[model samples]
Target chain A: MIDNLILGFQTALTPQNLLWCFVGVLAGTVIGLLPGLGSTTGVAVLLPLTLDFEPVTALIMLAGIYYGAQYGGTITSVLLSTPGEASSVVTTLDGYQMARRGRAGAALSIAAIGSFVAAIFSLILLMVLAPPFANFALKFGPVENLSIMILGLATIVSFSGESRIRGLAMASAGLLLATVGMDAATGTARFTFDNVNLLSGVPFVEVMIGLFAVGEVMYQIRVGAAAPIRTRFRELLITRSELRRSIGPIGRGSVLGFLLGCLPGSGSTLASFIAYGVEKRVSRNRSQLGQGAIEGVASPESANNAAANANFVPTLTLGIPGGGTTAVLLGAFTIYGLQPGPLLFQSQPKLVWGLLVSFFIGNVMLLVLNLPMAPIFAQMLRIPYAYLYPIILFTSFVGAYSIDNNMFSVWIVFVAGVAGYFMKLYDLPMAPLVLGLVIGPLFEKALTQTSALGDGDLLIVLSHPIALVVLALAVLLAAGPSLVRLLPRNTPDREREPAGV
Target chain B: MSTLIRIRGNGEATVYAMLALVGLAAAVSGAFYGVFVDGGRVGPGFLPLVAGGLTAVLCGWLALRGVHGRRSHPPGGPADGVEPHLAEDINPVDDATDDDVDISGRTRRERIHNLWKVFGLTLGAILLVQVVGFLAAFGALVFVISTWIERQPLLKSAVIAAAATGLIYGVFGLFLEIPLPGGLLGLGTEG
Candidate 1:
């Protein structure tokens, strides 16, 4: 393992790879600060540009973007009180308060420090656990695989938002959309409506660009951009006492973030929320929570970054994307002709290990970039949406068209954007749909293979102990919350907001 | 009829119910096109059938709940019945400040108008990209959006549009060689 780590660092430290890593993080921070552009959209819109690079370098850059965006989101949340990403929402609870009290510098500094600590912690866990987990996953058969996929879907639906039913419906819609192309079983075209483009299925990249990038632009235009409040950076350094108080919360948040992030469907947003709630309950100064407690700023910032990095585990090992951003990364893996599953470690050791190592370097780069530069990044909020959105629109169009060098995909982006706009307006979840789309083909194949192995006996799933246990857990995940609500206990924990991708 | 009308009156619930109906229709179409297959031999339509059916059932339930007015506020907001979709903060200090943008004050008609304008412009650009070229179509889009919807000065709009077009063309075309659509410009191959 030490040898592999050495090899990873050697590869990641190459001039070209390091340069791209810096560019990726820089671009990621810019996108993260931009309202409505989350990591998923940032990755999707920028994916085509990476196609011309070496696969390892490309993956390194993309991973940099993913975690860099986590740090980027904090700038807006702390300074302007406007969360740039869903996961940053919790940060705004106390972060904005700190900023208002002229402690923006302290809040931002602690956030950067906590993020650096948590990212390193999670990356360590990922390094130790990913290889063994992949080896364990290699033992699973079609039945077990299908059960696990079901479990993944169940977790996504359950944590998607206040409306589990709506989340499930969106997932279903995504599955239906995935089934649009030629069927693998019979070579029969389903839902193509006889269009040649439909023969290959809806292009997932175009869908992502449309739904996330284009849809966000349109939504922003309609809402009209607000002039951001500017905060002058007074103290870039956190006081020793403030740092001392944040240590425990940061530690707790790191562990909590990593665990939840490893779970399929549960993501950084949820991790941040749970971390904030826990900090409030257990902190020595609980009453000061919403009133700019430094621990409040520290915990969620650490947790979100940790969770963002930890999400890589399931994505790499099990081929189950932990959330929307990783789902897009999964798509990128497919685009690069590198299937991210248990075999990826064996087949593409350099790429996998190099990406892992690059993450370590990327976090260091982000901490350096964000600490003194957060105030500068906050100035990005002042860029008028009128001027900025048109550029986003143009890039989105070019991104969609460039994928296949055709206009058909561009049209798909337009339609998907419209659909996305309405979905957002109606408060329907988007992450579940993307998850379902990415997992649909795999789920279907696993189910069919399981059936074939079972000789068409549907009950065969019940006979496999592992599959049965996973399915049981899926059932429990789906029903446990509602069942618990029926009990005569204190009113349930606050209904969580829909998680951002 | 009255009960059905009442149910339809709930805007949020109606939308989900309509979506469920669409899913049910798709499920029926899928079933008609292929057999469900017996004895664990799943057919081509198996996934659609299951997914669509489940969507319909779940969405139907959501609609019913909405009709019953059982909709509960999400957890982050205060426990007050005020819909926290854009609710102000609970802290008096934060609430007293009026720095946040209040788009919620915009009338529904104005909001819809803005949405259509943006959507229409994007759709126009998509159609125009194939007819004129990427740069030209995009240039026109930026101009129209800035000048028309945003009501910027014509000269300013043109400058912004030109800069944007040049930037995109240079990056995707000159640097990456993406082979963007030439269309009428004939600068590159018609994609």
Candidate 2:
């Protein structure tokens, strides 16, 4: 393990890998700070640039974007009240409130520090735990693999958000969409209205960009833009009392985040929500919640960043992507003609270790890039709405076009954007739709493989221990959200100021 | 039913009904797929069938919930009608100003109109791609988005559009070598 760490450091420290990592982090920060452009879009847009580099360097760069964007996302959430990504939604509750209260500087700084600390801690955990987890992958057969995939699909249940029926519907739609391409098992066309492109299935990244980024941007545009509120750049440090308040939550979040990060289906997003939820649970001082609690910003921020790095554990060790972005990273592995499993450690030790080591370095780099720039991003709110919206639209188009170099993909962004806006207006959860889109194919393909093995007996899903345990987990995942809602409603009218612009 | 619907009240209830109807249609479509298709016990349509039925149930639930909300809080009180914060507000200030104005005039029609425009713009962009190609389609769409949706001044919008088109051409077409549709203006032709 020590040797692996040293080896990873050596590979990550090289000039080429470092350079790409820098580029990835830099681009990620800017894109993340921008509204309607999340880390996914940032990665998708820049994916073309990585094609020329070595697979390790490219992976490191993309990984940098993934983590850096998580850090950068808080900038908009803190300064302008606009959540740069879904994870930042909780951040805006306190972060933007902090800005309104003239503690924007402190909010921005703690967020950066919190992100850095969680990321570093999570990376260390990744180094220690990934090998064992990957080894555990050896235990998984076709039945277990299929069950794990089913468990991932079951996450749509968790995201149901006041409506299990809608959540199930969205997840099913995603599964149907997933079945579009030519059937790998029987060579039968499943649902591809025989359009050649449909024969290959819809690109997951394209669908994601459409659902989250484009749909979000259209919503923002229709709502019209806000002038970023300017605040006096006072002390940038957290107060002693504020620091004292944050320490417990941050500490709790670090531990909680690492655990959730270890899970296959739950990764950073769930970790953030759970961290925030737990902080609320543990708090004795109730008034601090809806009214600019520093812990509110720190807990989720740390968890999400940590979870972002932690998700690599499953991907690196077991060849399973616990989340959408990691799934794309997995695609990178296959693209390079290498599978990501225990064999990867034996055959491509440098790449595996280098990627892990680079994450630590990237987290540090992200803090340095973000802390001072937080206030500046807040000032992006100062930019007139006229200039900002055009730039937003322009970036969306550029990002879309860059994906496959085809205009059809770009058009999909607009169409999805429009569809998503309505979905949002109707109070549908976008994440389930996206999560479904992402995990659907994996579930379908795994189910097909299991059935092909003549494990069609529905009882097999219950009889196999791992499958049974996972099915139990699926039931729990389905129930967790309702339990959360039923939990004593903290505040009937929690004064939620919409994150600025 | 009409009396109940009327008691459910105006534009808001109508929107809910429309959404419920859409959900019902989707449910029917999904049920048809599930009932008809059978390759194995677990066919391809099973999931969709489940999703559609679930969606229909949820939509019905939502409509009922809306009705309940209306009943619980009758029209015209503080608890009734739309809350102040939730009210449709749209501020039509095109010029970006530092002075933050309360531009909160988002209307039901305006929201719907934007959706229609989005549908049109997307389909248009796809069609335009085949005719004039990526750059042209992109430029036109960006131009339309900037000038129309955003209501930017003509000159500013044009400059943004031109610069955006050029940047895309430079990065994607030249640097990345992704080969965006050249349309009538092939790569060799000088702009």
Candidate 3:
């Protein structure tokens, strides 16, 4: 581990890596702070721009964008009562209240501090746990891999919010879309309709750009932003008492977040929500929550940031994405000509370790950038949504066009954007759809291999102990919500929020 | 049935019904592709068949549940419908948002109109891309969206459009070496 850390620092501390990391985090912060854009859209829209760079450098920068958004989303939630991302949704409850009480600076500062602490804590956990997880995954066969894929799909059941069926529908839609290209098993075209572009299948990067960036812009256009609460620069500092109040929540949130984040599909948003809920139940100042308690901001913020890092655990170790953004990142690995999964750790140790180490540097940089400059960052809220929306649309189009240097990709963006708009309108879960798209090819390959191993019996997955256990777990995850719903309820339950990206 | 349809809400139910059709289409296509190919190997369409079939069933179930299903709001969640914060997620899509000005019906229509306008102009830009070229066409779309949809002043919108175009040309086209569609202008390295 020490040797790996040294190698990571050696690679990450390079002048080029550091420069891109700074750029990535800065871009990510601005992207997350914007009303219409979030980290997923941020990474998707900006990924094509990194095509000129080394794969490791591009990934480091993109990963920076991922974590940097965690801090950036807190700003809007605190000041404007607009959350830039789903994870920051919990923050706005008490964060905005803190601002209402003239403690905006304290809220923002504590959020940054909590997020920074959480990032370090989770990154350490990620670093320690991911290698061992990858080692275990290396032992997995095709049958086991197929079952794990089922488990991955089943995790989407947890993202079902109030409608398990809708989530399933979306996941199926994604899988259906993935089957458009030529069949690798038989070398026969399946759903291509003789179009060469379709033969390659729908590119996940372009789909991501469409769904997150273009789709989000359209959504934000209909729902305009509110005017932000003005905060003076002098009021941005955190006093000792506020930091003291934040300690417990921050610690609690970090642990809760990292654990939830490591689970495929749950990701950071759920982590933040559950962390906030736990703090509400357990904190000594619980009654003050949702009012102006610093605990609310600190806990969710820490959890979200920690969860963001923990998301890398499954992503790096299992090649199964922990959320929507990591799903896109996994797609990026394929685009970069690198196979994603356990082997990646052995084949690309420097790349993997360097990326992990850069998280530390990036969070430290975010803390330094966010703590003092938050008020200045808040000023960005003044930019009208009108200007931002057009910029996003235009970039999305251009980015799509650049993907294949053809018009078809742009058309895909348009179609996917419209689809994404309706999907959001209907409250459908987007993450499962994306994960399905990403994991589709892998799942199919595993199934094919497993079937061959079982002499044409696809049910051969049932015989392997690991595969059986994984399949059982998948069944449990999928059935858990519905079973709970069927059981008699003792108390009224608030409908759960979608485990959004 | 009329009462049930009304209670379930037309817009969302229609969306689910359409998805069911899409799933049916996929399943049909997968069946055509052959679920089991030669040598008894799982064919290319097997998973799609399974997934598509599942999608159809799930969506069909959803189309029924909408008559009066439980809401997704957390039990103790704030009633203001504050949408969850997400960087990768959009803002204030549902019941959330303190935007007081949009309460009027006219403004609501105008907002929906803006969304349509953006979508339409993008289609127009896509067609125009093969004519004037990608950058210019997209830039025009940006300009029209800002001036027309957003109602930004002409000069400001134009400058914004120009800057955006310049950024795209510089970063993606020039720097990344990812060829942009040259279209008629032939500015991009299409060959």
Off by over 4 Å in 2: A231-234, A318-320, A331-347, A388-407, A480-501, B1-123, B187-191
- Please list all clashing residue pairs in model 1, or write none if there are none: A456-B39, A495-B75
Tens-digit lDDT string for candidate 2 (A1-501): 989989999999999989988888887776777776777666655666677678999999998888888877787777777666656766777887788888878887888888888888888888888787667777777677777766665664564333455556555556555656765554455455557666767776666666666666666654554446464446477788888887777777777778776666554666776677677668655468647889988998998888888877767776666666776677667656788765677789899999988988887788887776666656665655545544455556656666666566776676677666656545455555555665666665666556545535545566578778987887787777566555565565443321110
Ranking by lDDT: 3, 1, 2
Candidate 1 global lDDT: 0.79
Note each model's CA RMSD in angstroms: 3.8, 5.9, 3.6
- Candidates 1 and 2 compared: the better one by TM-score is 1
**TM-score of candidate 1 to 2 decimals:** 0.92
lDDT of each: 0.79, 0.65, 0.80
TM-score evaluated only on chain B, model 2 = 0.54
lDDT at position A365, candidate 2: 83
Most accurate candidate by DockQ: 3
Listed in order, the DockQ scores are 0.39, 0.20, 0.41
The superposed Cα distance between candidate 1 and the true structure at residue A318, in angstroms, equals: 1.1
Top candidate, metric lDDT: 3
On lDDT, the stronger of 1 and 2 is 1
How would you encode candidate 3's per-residue C-alpha lDDT over B1-191 as one tens digit per residue? 68356544656666677787788888888888888876688887797788888888887667655544643332112211123433223234455433324422225457777788889999998998777778888888889988887777999999999999898888776777666667788855455
